[model samples]
Target: MRTKVAIIGAGPSGLLLGQLLARAGIDNIVLERRTPDYVLSRIRAGVLEQGMVDLLDEAGVGARLHREGLVHEGFALSFGGAGHRIDLKRLSGGKVVTVYGQTEVTKDLMEARAAAGLTTIYEAESVTLIDWETSSPRVRWVKDGLAQELTCDFIAGCDGFHGVSRATVPSTAIRNFERVYPFGWLGILSETPPVDHELIYVNHPDGFALCSMRNPMLSRYYVQCRFDDKVDDWSDERFWDALKSRLHGEAAERLVTGPSIEKSIAPLRSFVAEPMRFGNLFLAGDAAHIVPPTGAKGLNLAASDVRYLSSALIEHYDTGSAAALDRYSEQALARVWKAERFSWWMTSILHRFPETGGFGQRIQQAELDYLVGSEAAMTALAENYVGLPY
Candidate 1:
C-alpha cells in the first residue's frame, strides 16, 4: 500500500499531524504499536497553551475541549508560606490557558479521524522507516504476524522517545543533549475537588509539590521524590500529609483528602536532538525532545512542532515550495530551545535541590520574591506560561 505520509505512532502528535494533512487532502496512514485504549489510559499534563488549543481547533477537534475543559486566567506560585497569583490573562494581554488533559486531546483527535474515515493501524509491531534519505520513503511493520510495507512521500516519527523511529537514525548523524534530574515526581489522582480553582505550584523546604486537576471532581497532585522512591512506599494517608505540609495558609486548610485512584513516579529530564528533520523523516513531539513538566510545555511543544511541520508540508504540496520544509528544523528548534530554557528555569527555581546547597535555596526564594513583586518579571512569567507566539 502507499500514502503521501506514513506516520508512526498514533499518539497526539501523529494523530494531530494526520488530521491536519488529511484535511488538506493529503493521503496518510498512522501506525501505532499500542491499542487505542492503552493510549488513552496514559495520563498526562492538562495545561493547554493558546497556540495548541488553536491548532486542535484547526484540526476540527476542539468542540469537546471548549465544552468541558477548564479555562484559567492565572495560576499561583506558593512560596515562603504565602501564595502569589500571577494574572496570566492580564499579564499576557488577554491570553489564557485551557486545562484539558492530554488524554482528552488524543481522544478528540482519534474520534475526528474515525469520523473522517481515516486509517490508523493499532498494535503495529516492529515499525521501521526506510529510505528516508532519498526522495521516497517506506514504512514496514508487522501486524497479525504478517509483514506489511507502505510506500510514502515522507515519514513522521511521532512514536515517542522509546519508539523505533529516532532509534533507526544513525547515531553519528544526530547530536543529543540531555539532563536527567536527581528527583522524580510521585503523583496521584483522586476523586476530590481541587485545592483551588487555579493550579498551585508550591515551593517548600521539604520539596516541590503541584496542585493540578483533570476536572471539577478529579484532582491530580504531585510531590518531589528521590530517584529511588517507589509508589509502594507512598500510601494515601502519607501522600496527603506530605501534600498538606507543603501548602500554606488557606490552601493548606482547604485541601481535601481521599483515596488515590492512580499512582506513579515520573523522572524529570530535559532532552533534545538537534536537526529535527532527518531527510524525509521528520521528528515531532517526544520522538525529538522532552521537557520537564514544570513549564507544562511537553505536549504543547509537540503541537508546535506539528504546526511548523504541517505548514511546511502544506507549503511544499500547495506551491511546490520546499522553503518552509527546508527551514523546518531551524524554525522548530528556535522555539524548542526557548521552551527548554523556560522549563529548565521553572524546574530550577520551583524544586528543592540539595546539591544547590543553602545558597541555591536562598537564590530560589529571592527569584520567587522578585517574580511576584515586579510587574516586568510577572509579565515575563505570564507570557511564557500562556505561551510565546507560534
Candidate 2:
C-alpha cells in the first residue's frame, strides 16, 4: 500500500488528522489495532474546550456533538466543605466547554471517515513501523493472518503511549520527561444521575473526588486511590459508600447508583516527548505527550497537536519546503509544556499527597479556600480550565 501520508492509529488524533489532510487534498491511510466497536465503546475524556469544539464545528464534524453534547459555562470546585464556581464564560469572554466523551468524538469521526469512503484496518496485529529515516516510511503489519507493507511519504505516529511508533524512533533522538503520581483514579460510569449540577471537583481530607456526567441518565465519577488498587477489591457497596463519604451532604445525594456501566483504575501521570518529530516521522497526541486527567486537557491537547501537525504536513506537501516541518517540534512543545504545567498544577493542588500534613495540609486548604473566595483566583482557574488562549 502507498499513500501521501500514513497515520498509525484510528483514535481521534489519527482520524481527525486524516480528515484534515484529506480536506487539504492530501491522501492518507489510517490503521488501528482495535475493532470499530471497541474504539467507539471505550470511555475516556469527556470534556471539550472551546477551541476544540469550534474546530470540530468548522471541520463539519460537530453536527451530532452540537446536538448531544451538554454545554456548560463553568464547573464547581469544592474544598473545605464549600463550593466555589469558576464562571468560564465570565472569565474567558463567553468561552465554554462541552461535556462529551472522547469516545463519542471517535464515533463521529469514524462515521465521517466511513461515509467519506475511508477504510480503517482493525484487529491488525504484529504491527511494525520501519524506515522512518528514509524518504519513504514503511509500516508493516499482519492483519488477520496476512502480511502487508504500507509505504508513505510522511508518517504520523498517532498511536497512544504504548504504540510502536514511539518505540521505533531511536532513543537517541528522543528526550522523554515523565512524572508518575503515587495515586491513580478510580473512575466509574454509573447508570445513576449526576450528583451535581455541574462537574464538581472536590478536595477532601480523604482524597480527591470528581462528579461528572455523561448525560441525563449516566453519571461519571472518579476518586483518588493508590496506584495498585484493583477493581475486584472494590465492590458496588464499598464504591458507593466511599463516594458518598468523600462527596458529602448534598453532593452525595446526587450519586444515586442504579448500575455501573464501567469501572477501572487509571494511573495518573504527566509525560512529554521533547522534539516530537524526527526525520520523516512526526508524533501527535498521546504518542507525544500525556497530561494527568485532573485538568481535562488530554483530548483537547491531542486535538491541538493534530491541528498543528496536519497544517504543517499540508504546507510541506504544497511547497516542498521543510520549514514548517523543521519547526514542528518547537511549535508543538510550547503548547504541550503549557498544558503539562497546568495539569501538574491542578493535580498537585487538588490531590492530597502522602507528604502533605500539619502546616502543609493547612497551607493547601488555605490556598483552596482563597482560590474559591477570590475572583482573581477563580478567573485564573477558569481561564486555564476553559483553555489557555488556544
Candidate 3:
C-alpha cells in the first residue's frame, strides 16, 4: 500500500493531522496499534483551550463538541480554605475554554474520518518505517499475523510516549529534559454532580485536590498522592474523607459521592525531547513531550504540533518546497518549552512536598496568598489557564 503521508497512531494528533491533510487534498493512511473501542474510551484530558476548540470546529470535527461541550468562563482557586474565582473572559479579553474529554475529541475525529472515507487501520501492530532516504518514506508493519509495507511522502509518528517511533530516532541525535515530582495524582471518575460551579484547584496543608467535571452527572476529581501509592489503597470512603478535608466548611450536600467508574495514579512529571523531527519521521503529542497536567496543556500542545506539521506537509506537497518542513523541529519546540515551563510552575506551587518540614508549607501558602491578593498575579494565572495562542 502507498499514501502521500503515513501516520502512526490513531490518537487525536494523528487523526486530526489526517483530517487536515485530507482537506488539503493530501492522501494519507493512519495505523493504530490498539482497537478502535480502546482509543475511543481512553479517558484523559478534558479542558480545551479557545484555540483547540477553533481548530476542531474549523476541521469540521466539533459538531458533537459544540452541542454537548461545557463552556467555562473561568475556574476557581482555593487556598487557606477560601475560594477565589479567576474570571477568564475578563482576564483574556473574551477568550474562554471548553470542557470536552480527549476521548470524545478522538471519537469525533474518528467518526468524521469514517464518514469522509479516510484510510484509518486499527489494531495494526509491530509498525515500523524503512527507506527514509529514498524519494518516499516506507512504513513496514504486521497486522493480523501478516506482514505489510507502505510507502508515503512523509511519516508522522504520533504514537505517543511509549511507541516505537521514538526508538527509531538515533539516540545520539536526541536531547532530553525531564523532572520527576515526588508526588502523583490519584484521579477518579465519579457518578456524582460537580461540587463547584467551575473547576476548583485547591491547595491545602495536606496536599492538592482538584474538583472538575465530565458532565452534569459525572464528576472528575484528583488528589495528590505519594509516588508509590496504589489506586486500591484509596477506598471510596477514604477518598470522600480526603476531599472533605480539602474542601472543609463546604456544604456536605454539595460534595455528593458516588460509585467510581475509573481510577488511575498518574505521576507528576515534565519531559521534553528536542528536534521533534528525525529524517522522514516526525513525532507529535506525547511522543515528543509530556506536561505535568496541572495546567491542562498536554492535549493542547499536541493539537498545536498538528497545526504546524500539517501546514508544513501541505506546503511541501502543493508547492514542492521544503522550507516549512525544514523548520518543523525549531518551531514545535518553542511552544513545547513554554508549556513545559508553565506546567512545571503550576505543579510546583499546587503540590505539597514530603521533605518540606513546615517551611515549604508556608511558602506554598504565601504563593497562594499572593495569587489572591495581587491582580497582576491572578491575571497571569488566568491567561495561562485560558491558554496563550498557538
Candidate 4:
C-alpha cells in the first residue's frame, strides 16, 4: 500500500496534521503504537492558546471545544500571602485562553477522522522510517504479527520525544539541547469543585503549586516534588494537605478536598532538537521539542508546529514549490526557541531551587513584585501566557 504522506503518531499533533492535510485533499495515513483508548487515557495540558483554538476550528473539530471549554480572561499569581491577578484578555488586547484538556482535543480529532473516513492505524508495532533521505520515503510496521509497508512522498515524525521518528536520525546529523529540572510535578485529579473559577499559580516556601481544572466538577492540581519521588509516596490525604499548605488566604480556605482518581509524578525538562526537518522526514510536536509545562506551552507548541508543517506541505502540493518545505525547520525553530525561553523563565521564577538558598528566594519574590507592579512586565507575561503570534 502507498500514500502521499505517512504520519508516525496518533497523538494530537499527528491527528491535527492528518485532518488538516485531508481537508486539503492530501492523502495521509496515521500510525500509532497504542490503541485509541490508551491515547485518551493520558491526561495532559488543560490550556489552549488562541491560535491553537483557531487551528482546531480550521480543522472542523472545534464545536465541542467551544461548547464545553471554559474561557478564561485572567489567572491568579500568588507569592507570599498575596495573590495578584494578571488580566490576560485586557493585557493581551482581548486575547483569551480556553481551559480545555489535551485528551478532549485528541478525542474530538479522533472522532472527526473516523467520521471523514480518514486512515488511522492504531497499535501499529515497531514502526520505522525507511528511505527518508531519498525522494520516495517508506514506512514499515507490524500488526497482528503481519508485516505492512507503505511508500510515501513524505514521512511526518509526530510520534513523540521517545519515538523512533527523531531517534532514527544519526547522532552526527542532529544537535540536541536539553535541561532537566531538579524537581517533578506530583499531580492529582479529584472529583471536587475547583477552589477558584480561574487557575491559580502559587510560589511558596514549600514549593510551586498550580490549581487547574478539566470541568466544573473536576480539579487538576500539582505540587513540586523531588526528582526521585514516586506515585506511591503521595497519598490522597497527603497530597491535599501539601496543596493546602502552599495556597494562601481565601484560596486555601475555599479549597475542597476529595478522593484522587488519578495520580502521577511528571519530571520537568526543557528540550529541543534543532533543525526539525531530516530530509523527507519532518518532525512535529513532542517528537521535536518539549517544555517544562510551567508556562503551559507543550500542547500549544505542538499545534503551532502542525500549523507550519501543514501549510508548507499544502503549499508544496498546490504550487509544486519546495521553498516553503525547505524553510520549514528554520521557520519552526524561530518560534520554538522563543517558547522555550518563556517556559524556562516561568519555571525559574515559580519554583524553589536547592542551590538558590535564601538569597535566591528573595530575588525571585522581588522579580514577582516588579512584574505585578509594572504594566510592561505584566503585558510581557500576558503575551507569552496567552501565546505569542504564530
Candidate 5:
C-alpha cells in the first residue's frame, strides 16, 4: 500500500490527525493494535480545554460535544475545610472548559472516519516503522496471520508511550526527562449525580481528591493513594467514604453514592522525550510527552501537539516547503514544557507527598490561600486551566 502519511495507533491523536489531513486532501492510513471496541472501552480524563474543543470542531466532531459537554465557568478549590471558587471566566478573560470524556471524543472521530470511508486497520499486529530516517519510510504489520507493508512519505507515531513509535527512535538521539511520583490516583466511575455542578478539587490533610463528571448522571472521582494500591483494595463503600471525608460541608452533604462501574489506580508521572520529531517520523500525544493529571493537562497537551503537527504538515504540502516541518520539534516542545511545568506545579501544591514533612504541608496551604485570595494568582491558574494558546 502507498500513502502520503502512515499513522500508527487509532487513538484520538492518530484519528484526529488523520481526519485533518484527509479533509485537507491528503491521503493517510491509521493502524491500531487493538479492536475498535477495546479502544473505546478504555476510560480516560473528561476535562477539555477550549483549544481541544476547537480542534474537535475543526475535525467536524464537535456537534455532539457542544450539545452534550458540560461547560464550567469556574471550579472550586477546597482547602482548610472549605470550598473556594476560582472564577475562570472572570479571571482568564472569559475563558472556560468543557467536560467531555475522551471516550466520547474517540467515538465521534471513529464514527466520522467510518462515515467518510477513511481507512483504519484494527488488530494490526507487530506494527513497526522502517526507514523513517530516509526520504521514503514504510510501516510493517501482521494481520490475520499475514504480513503486510505500507510505503508513505512520512510516519506519525501516535501509538502512545508503550507503542513502537517512541521505541523506534534510538536512545542515543533522544534525551528523556521523567519524574515518577510516589503516589497514584485511585479513581472510580459511578452512575450518580456529581457532588457539585462544577468540578471540585480538594486538598485535605489526608490526601488530594477531585470530583469530576462525564455528565449530570455519571460522576468520576479520584483520591490520592499509595503506588502499590490496587482496585481490590478499595471497595465501592470504602472509596465513597474516603472521597467524602476529604470534601467539606455542602460538597460532602450533596454527594450521591453508588456502586462503582470502573475502578483503577493510575500512577502520576511527568515525562517528556525531547525533539518530538525524528527525521520523517513525528511523535504526538503520549508518544512525545506525559504530564501529571493534577492540572488536567494530559489530553489537552496531546491536542496542542496535534495542532502544531497538523498545521506544519498542511503548510509543507501546500507550499512545498519544509520550514514548518523543520521547526515542528522546537515549536511543539515550547508548549509541551510549559504544560509540564503547570501540571508539576499543580501536583506539587495539591498532593500529599510522603517526604514533604510538616513544612511542605504548610507551604501547600499557603499556596492555595494565595491562589484563591490573590487576583494575579487566580488569573494564572485560570489561564493554565483554560489552556495556553495553540
Candidate 6:
C-alpha cells in the first residue's frame, strides 16, 4: 500500500495528526500495535492548553470537549499549611485551561476517523520502519499472521518512548538528555465529588499532593511516593488519610473519601531527544520528549508538536516547499525545551527531595512564598500553567 504519510501509533498524537492531515486533503494511514480497547483504557493527563483545545476545534472534534470539559480560571497552591490561589486567567491575559480526560480526546478522534473512513491498522505486530533515509520510506508489520508493507512519502513517529519509532534512530545521530526523579506519584481515581471546585496543588512536609477532577463527581488525586513504593502497599483508607494530611484548612475538611476505581504509580522524569527529524522520518510526542507531570504539560506538549508537524507537512503539500519540513526538528525542539524547563521547575518546587535536607525545604518554602506573594512570579507561573504560546 502507498500513502502520503504513514503514522506509527494510534495514540492521541497520531490520531490528532491523522485527522488534521486528512482534513487538509492529505492521505495518511495510522498503524497501532495494540487493540482499540487497550488504547482507550490507558489513563493519562487531562489538562488542555487553549492551543490544544483550539486545535481540536480545527480538527472538528471539539464539540463534546467544549460541552463536557470543565474550565478553570485558577488553581490552588498549598504551602505552609494554607491554600493560595493563582489567577491563571487574570495573570495570563484572559487565558484559561480545560479539564478534559485524554481518553475522551482519543475516543473523539477515533470516532471522527472512523466516520471519515480513514485508514488505521490496529493490532499491527512487530512494526518496523525501513528506508527512512530514502525518498520512499516504508513501514512493515504483521497483521493476522500475514506480513504487509506500506510505502509513504513521509513517516510520523508518534509512538511513545518505548515504541519502535525512536529506536530506529541511531545513537550517533541524536543527543539524549534525561533526569529520572527519585520518587513517583501514587494516584487514585474515585467516584466522589472533588474537595475543591478547582484543582489544588499541595507542597507539604510529607510530600507533594494534587487534587484534580475529571468531572463534578469523578475525582483524581495523587500523593508523592518513594521509588520503591507499590500500589498494593496502600489501601483506600490509607491513601485518603495520607492525602488529607498534606492538605490544610477547608481543603482537608471538605475532602470526600471513597473506594478507588483505579489506582497506579507513575514515575517522574524529564527527557528530550534532539533533532526530532531523522531524514524522511519525524518524531512527535513521547517519541521525542517526556516531562514530569507536575506542570501538566505532557499532552499539551504533544499537541504543540502535532501543531508544528501538521502545519509543516501541510505547507509542503500545498506550496511544494520543504523549508518548514527541513526545520521541523529545530522548531519543535525550541518549544519542547521550554516546556521541559517549566515541568522541571514545577517538580522541583513542589516535591520533597530526599537529600535536600532542612536547608532545601526552607528554600522551597521561600520560593513558594515569593511566587504567591509577587505578581510577576504569579504571572509567570500562570503563563506556563495555561501553556506557553504554541
Give the candidate number with the greatest lDDT.
6
Please identify model 1 stretches exceeding 4 Å from their true place: none
Evaluate model 2: give its TM-score.
0.97
TM-scores of the candidates in the order shown: 0.99, 0.97, 0.97, 0.99, 0.99, 0.99
Kindly state the number of residue pairs that clash in model 2: 0
lDDT tens digits by residue: candidate 2, 1-390: 889888989999999998888878899999888888888877898899988887787566899999999999988888877677788999887889999989889988888888988767888788888888889789888986999999999889999999978988888889999999999998889887788768988888889999899898889888888889999878777777777888756777656876677999999999999888878899999999999999899999998888888878889889988898888889888988999998998898788898767777788887887887788888888888888764
All candidates' lDDT scores? 0.95, 0.87, 0.88, 0.96, 0.94, 0.96
The TM-score of predicted model 3 comes to 0.97
- Model 5 stretches with alpha carbons more than 4 Å out: none
Q: For model 2, what is the alpha-carbon lDDT of residue 225?
A: 87
Off by over 4 Å in 4: none
User: What is candidate 3's lDDT per residue for 1-390, written digit by digit as tens?
Assistant: 989999999999999999999988999999999999998877898999988898898789888998989999998887876788889998888888999888889989999999999999888988877866466889888888999999887889999998877778878989988888998999999889999768988888889999999888888999998899999999988888888788746733479988889989998789998889888888999999999889799999999999999999989988999999989988999989988888988887888888886888888888888888888988888888888777
- Please say which candidate is ahead in TM-score: 2 or 5: 5
Ranking by lDDT: 6, 4, 1, 5, 3, 2
lDDT of 4: 0.96
List candidate 2 stretches off by more than 4 Å.
none
Candidate 2, residue 141: the lDDT equals 88
Q: C-alpha displacement of 205 in model 2, angstroms?
A: 0.5
The TM-score, computed over Cα atoms with residue i paired to residue i, of candidate 6 is 0.99
Which residue pairs show collisions in model 4? Answer: none
Candidate 4 C-alpha lDDT tens digits along 1-390: 899999999999999999999999999999999999999999998799999999999999999999999999999999989899999999999999999999999999999999999999999999988999999999999999999999999999999999999999999999999999999999999999999999999999999999999999999999999999999998898999999999988899999999999999999999999889999999999999999999899999999999999999999999999998999999899999999999999999999999999999999999999999999999999999999898
